[model samples]
Target: MSTADTTQSAVVAKLSGLDRFLPVWIAAAMVVGLLAGRWVPGLEGALNAVAIDGISLPIALGLLVMMYPVLAKVRYDRLDTVTGDRKLLLSSLVLNWLFGPALMFALAWLLLPDLPEYRTGLIIVGLARCIAMVVIWNDLACGDREAAAVLVALNSVFQVIMFGALGWFYLSVLPGWLGLPQTDLAVSGWQITANVLVFLGIPLVAGYLTRRLGERAKGRDWYEARFLPKIGPVALYGLLFTIVILFALQGEQITSRPLDVVRIALPLLAYFAIMWAVSYAVGKAAGLNYARTTTLAFTAAGNNFELAIAVAIATFGAASGQALAGVVGPLIEVPVLVALVYVSLALRRRFTASTTEAS
Candidate 1:
């Protein structure tokens, strides 16, 4: 293997064990954030003022920290390899755009309609896909990094286009099914696009630039060994801290409507299960290898809750049901995806062994 591949492989190995525990840590952080929010109600407001222009500083910081490591790991040269994996790209797009949203709408309509707050919340959650977090998960799952990067880039672009369309359609066109009145979908298409660019695209560009600079200054080995690892924990901590502030801001609503957790969890769990099964089956049918299959599975299973929450708070008010639903998504998604990671590992061994035997 090349030097860069060897370095990446070592980093991936060290991360393999740690990856399984991240969901647990994230879950613990959520609980702590919720408790902190409940006890120290003013904390979120204090953090909220840390912003540039109108954007929340805490959130912007979180996005930067969360995205930096992910961006650093991305081999931009891999972008060239993306087109070679036509099956992975097509499967991800179809499942994410068509099947994923359809299932979420059906579940929300069936399960959450009577609860307008939760209904709107589910709608917001369902519309977004995991743009940032999936990269980490894909790496952990030993997925196709090139494919993951392309999907992340594509999903980021699609969220700008599809979020407003999906939001409006879910609210107005699907009102009969969801039993919710038509309300202005709050965020315009342009607004969603702008937020993605600011939150996702900008940070991604910064990350890439930083990685390139590090490579030039210290070489790739030094960059990966020293810089990337240091950034990982910082980013994770920033994400956790931001979650605490968000929960604190929404403390009263969350405390008052405790049952909303149950309301949101059902649809989220259902969505994860259905999407995983579909992605795996489709990948297998297309005759993809294990790594490609895992990439497809996670790409389908994860939602971009950060963007969703931002748009939700912007459009639906911070304490609106929709915003709450978006917050609740990661709480459900993290643990469920961790479980699916194990599932993917099991499937990988089985599939890889079969492939080896066949060959």
Candidate 2:
């Protein structure tokens, strides 16, 4: 075979390996964390103690590492291109900021109203728009990487502001509307701002600088082909590390109330499915290219659970049911989104077939 065919074959094999090993790695992380939590109970506390303003310093660092590589792919210079596709940009903004939160509120309120802490946790997760994991999902679906990066950066900024304001409003003052007692939580805007900056601002700056400096020193082709491919997996590793830490920290609660995890996941699972369908349909109707459509769908459907857990722990105690709910968010997220990855791939084939026929 020609070198071209050989290279294509190699690339296919690599992707297949990734899909096969992805679940294995996730399961290994889960087992290690669970075993550590069960056996070495002191370890979780040791990690948790090195905290600042309700955010664990170690986990915060892990999140920064997870985020930077994803952001580095943005080609900050081409962010203007996202503006050229106003339909996708506007559609994502409307759905993420408006419809998404309202839908979560309705579901959490309708389904988990009796359990206020879990309900509050769900609301917090809803308010925290995803900035990191959506890239992975979009990539899995063969979506526009550039568009996903720009939307993530945009969502990161918007969520930093909206999370605190909306969180305080929905979780605190709005209880009067529901005739429920105000959640006895004091949310400091400054603390939430600090968490957002630590988690998002640091990585965003680092990612842009890494791309620019690498390109200046090594050229664009080397930066993309050599440097990015090496660092890209860091995001997934960091994510698994964060998950382990979260699970370890809350092992007792997780072990004791298995059903509570399920309860929290139910609304979230529904939210993911419904949000994906709506955003996908809207994007298709608006005539977005398949890449932009899938990016919008995954971005709209994803939640920034890291920020949710931070804000929850800061406002409520770490062991609070609200915090437990935040922990469960990631537990349910992995398997559910993994399934969606396959679904997205399957749908893409149909989408491509239809577009080809039309052309």
Candidate 3:
């Protein structure tokens, strides 16, 4: 076999059982939740009744569980390496913070002019950015792992700081200025801030502390190789658990308004495709090699669906259209990004060919 084929097989082999079939698992969860919600009596009310300070306890737990391990996997101590690459750092910041949110705002507004809840949700999804799954996608595509870790850490910081302000601006202020119909998300700006603090803030701190303390006690090798693998699967468990609950709560709405789900999906599909292609092109034009270019593309394209879903459910409700929109994010993202991984791999070979010819 060719060297490229062998490398490809190895990379694909690294995808754990859960990661490889993520879409299928998520779909199964959705189906189970939907069936339970549709057929079983009083399930929604039971789920709703168990809330801690208005946020669903199950969902809050799921959000934390879904986020913490991923954050722990970030190589926080090595951030300076990525920071030194000004071209890559500046490009990533621009693509993630500036261009990504703006593009989603435009697409959400353009595509879902009449559906304010889904639009707001999409905007929230955009603002959340990718702090978790981009690492996996980057690795699958042979992107620079250290770059992905640093970028994910960078995104986590921005998400906590900017999510609420950006949420208020896009959901309330921007629409008013544009003379567009604004959504009464029924939550104040401060409430959004509080939710961001509780959900993203808590997990970020916990993850950082876990990494620092673990590495200090047991060394980096033990922390990453031994400790991280043990907790890695928990994130998937939490993700699936959250998805089931979300779909169950919103089952009636989802089943009733299937078209709205499709409507919600269109903007997301476009956002991922456009953001990735543009970010990849930007990375290449800026003279990044294939790995860093791929890293930039995945990091720029992915969203923090866990954060978005938590925020949507916390700010709105578990059964809100906004929450449903958040749920749809990973459904669309998993398959699309999995496809993009192969696309990145194909382009990697092309990149190599071009470099060889140039030399």
Candidate 4:
């Protein structure tokens, strides 16, 4: 068998039940949520009844559950190693922070100019960088695992620091400067910070502490091989749970406005394609090996949708269009990124052949 074929089989072997059919699970969750919201009496009211300072308690729990396991998987100790690689580090920062967000902003406006709520939501999605699933994509495509880990950690720190400021700029300030219509989000930087703190901060700190303690007590092998597998599935469960609740809250809007869902999806589809393609080209030009190039591409292309969804629902109510836009994010991202994984592997074979010829 070709090396690519072997790698593909290995990836398939590694996929857990939750990870293998994530798109299917997400679709099912959306359907279940829509049905419950539409048919079940008082389901929406019951979900909305318990709020933690205007955020639904059930949703908040789901967000925390989704975020914790993924963050906990990050290798916080390896940051120094990746940071020392200036080319990889700088290229990643530029692609993720600068190029990724700007591209999404342009796409959101260019595509959904009339739909302000969904537009704002897409822009918000842009600012939230990837911290979770890039690891899986990277591994599946035979990318650099350590690079993915360190990069995810870097993105997490930047996420805490930069998300609110960027949100304010993209949503409020930048539009006014450019004569585009401003978002009606009505949120301050501090409010965004507070919401991020409650949603992202709590889980981030918890994940870090869990990793630190787990490694110290049981050693890295046990923590990774034994403990991580135990907690790993929780992230998907939490994601599906959150999606169900989100759709349940906004089912009427989503089911009724199918076209709007398509509208929200276009920019997302464009964003992933452009970001991955550009990052891959850049990685190749910068003299990266195929593995590191793949790592850079996936990391650059992916967004922290979990964070995006949490921020959207927190700032705008669960039923808001902004939240709906966020909900549609994973629905599009899961399938698209999965396709990119195959693309990356196919390119890997060509990449290997060319390198072999050159050497």
Candidate 5:
């Protein structure tokens, strides 16, 4: 390898350890957000004041900044290989769509039947897969960056297409299995498409363009060394502030319905545990390496809360129980995934030892 390749590898190695703590910081931000929401209700309106053309500027900016590096790293040419890993892809698809959702629905019903609003919220949270944050987790787990990029891209597309269908199925079809009333869950496809385009699509294009331009002017090594790291913290802090605002806006609901938060936690925790195990097992059975397995496991476990939250607000009002359920997803997800990263590292070492001994 060239000196630049060696340096970049070293940087990625150092970053692997630091990346594990990001979720902790994100969790801490959520707590701070809740406290801020409770203590200072006025900040919500102040945050709203800085809106841009009807969208929350801070939230939009946060998502854009957070997604830049993620999109930049995507190797579009490798997407073809996704079909080559048909077994892995099929396993993920079934787990994400069929098994994962069924388990979440059952758990939500078992845990929050009395609270229909929260039940709907949990369903919404479960139907969506991770779009933004999973990229970071995949990197930390030393996952297959190419497969991850392809999955991320594919999941984004699937989310837009399957969201309303899966959502309707959850609200209408699944509830009947549990003897719950069939309610029509309304979601505006156009509005959701718009939000996805603005928040996710635009940033993704911008990141791709920026990376391409930078490579032409300065070289890939220069871009990686000088530009990427500088923007890393901006994305982190942007997400932090957005969480603060979200909590601030929903502070009253959170405070009034404290028990409801606990109610949502059980199903979410169960969903993560079950899905993580299933993904890991499937990856191993498919003969994937540790890196790709970690990617698959995390991709299955994480929820795309940004889309869920936006849909919750659009479908059920900003302070609706559904929206709150979406918010609670990340609150639980961040910490659990962080712990799982450590678990993944342990598994990697064990697998390596076994392989070496066998060799």
Candidate 6:
């Protein structure tokens, strides 16, 4: 095989172990989180007892840990490259902010209108946008790594700016404007801005400094191939830890209203599938290649549940039904994205042919 073929095989081999079995790890997390919440007396409470301003300290740390590695991998210098792919970039932003949120808003109302807290929670999940985990899904689908990195960075900034205002508009303002029943969300503008700074703000700065310093010290070759490999798994490990802590705190909610998780998941599952189809079709129609297409698709379909969960807990209490809805986003997100990864891979076959023919 050519050197390129060999390198591709090696990369796939490295990614496949964790990427292919992500659903399993998530399932394990669910089981252990539920069991710990049920069986271990005071464990959930103990972890949650250590909180400031209604945010669980452990999950906050976990989210920070999970986020930094993903952020650190971004080549911020290459972000300029996305500007050239204006159609690709524009498509991602439109789908994520406009179409994606509207679809989620409609779904939340249509699916669980009576459960106002949970519906608001679902809306929060949609509005936050995916900054971190979609990188994993994007990579698994052989997306443009550079584009994925750029979009991740872009979305991080976008969410910090847009999430607060858009969230207010959808959950509070627009509903009142439209004469629909408002969810009566109590999150203040200051609180919303602070949450963004506390969460995304820290990691974005840290990741930027880390990358710049690493490159200056060791150079790009060492930073990408050697440095990144060692730390890349931190995100996945922290993700599982957060999942356990989340379900642990939600033990009572899970046990009493297990079906509520399912009910909430219904819109989420539909959201993922529909969002993928929409982004995928849009990418193809825009004449983007397979890599860019899958990158946009994953970016559109995925949720920034870490931010969503944090906002929910900060806005609503940790044990609130809203927080429970935030937890369910990942639960519903993982398996569905895993399935979409397969679908995107299958679609890649067709996309590759079309691109080749056009070229």
Give the alpha carbon lDDT tens digit for every residue of 86-155 in model 2: 8988999999999998899889898997998889888888888887667777876667878987787788
**lDDT (10s digit) by residue, model 6, range 270-342:** 8989999999999999988888899999999998786787788777876788888898888788778878887
Q: Write model 1 residue lDDT over 1-359, tens digit each, in one string.
A: 64434544454466633464676776777777778777874777787767654467776777667666777677777677776778778888899988888888789878886887777777777788777667666766778877777887888888877887887787778775555576557766666666667667876888789878889999999888888777766656656665665565566666777787788889889988899888999999999888788888898889877677777777778777788888778777877877787677656656755665687
Shift of residue 17 alpha carbon in model 6, Å: 2.6
lDDT of each: 0.75, 0.79, 0.80, 0.81, 0.76, 0.80
Off by over 4 Å in 4: 131-149, 156-179, 182-185, 198-200, 289-292, 304-323, 342-359
Question: Relative to the unseen true structure, what is the C-alpha lDDT of residue 9 in candidate 5, on a scale of 0 to 100?
Answer: 50
- Global CA lDDT of candidate 4, please? 0.81
**RMSD list, candidates in order:** 4.4, 3.6, 3.8, 3.7, 4.4, 3.4
lDDT of 4 by residue, 1-359 (tens): 97656655676677777777776887899889888888888888899899765567888798789778877876778767767878998999999998999999999999998888899889988998877566657765778766876776677777767877788788889999999877645434554444556666687789889999999999999999999899888877887897788778767767787888999999999999999999999999998989889999999999877567667877787677888898788768876987888788678777766666787
Q: Which ten-residue region of model 2 has the weakest summed lDDT?
A: 3-12
TM-score of each: 0.86, 0.89, 0.78, 0.79, 0.86, 0.85
Give the per-residue lDDT digits (tens) of candidate 5, residues 1-359: 64444543554467633364676676778788788877884877876787643456767777677667666766545667766888778777877777777888888888887888888888888887776777766766667867876676677777778889988888998667767787677877775566667766786788778878888899889888898777666655656676676666667677778788888888899999889988999888888878778889998898878777777877788878888898788778877887887678667765565556677
Q: Which residue pairs show collisions in model 6? A: none
Candidate 3 lDDT: 0.80
> Best candidate per TM-score, number?
2
Worst 10 residues of 5 by lDDT: 2-11
TM-score of 5: 0.86
lDDT of 5 at 331: 73
lDDT of 1 at 186: 71
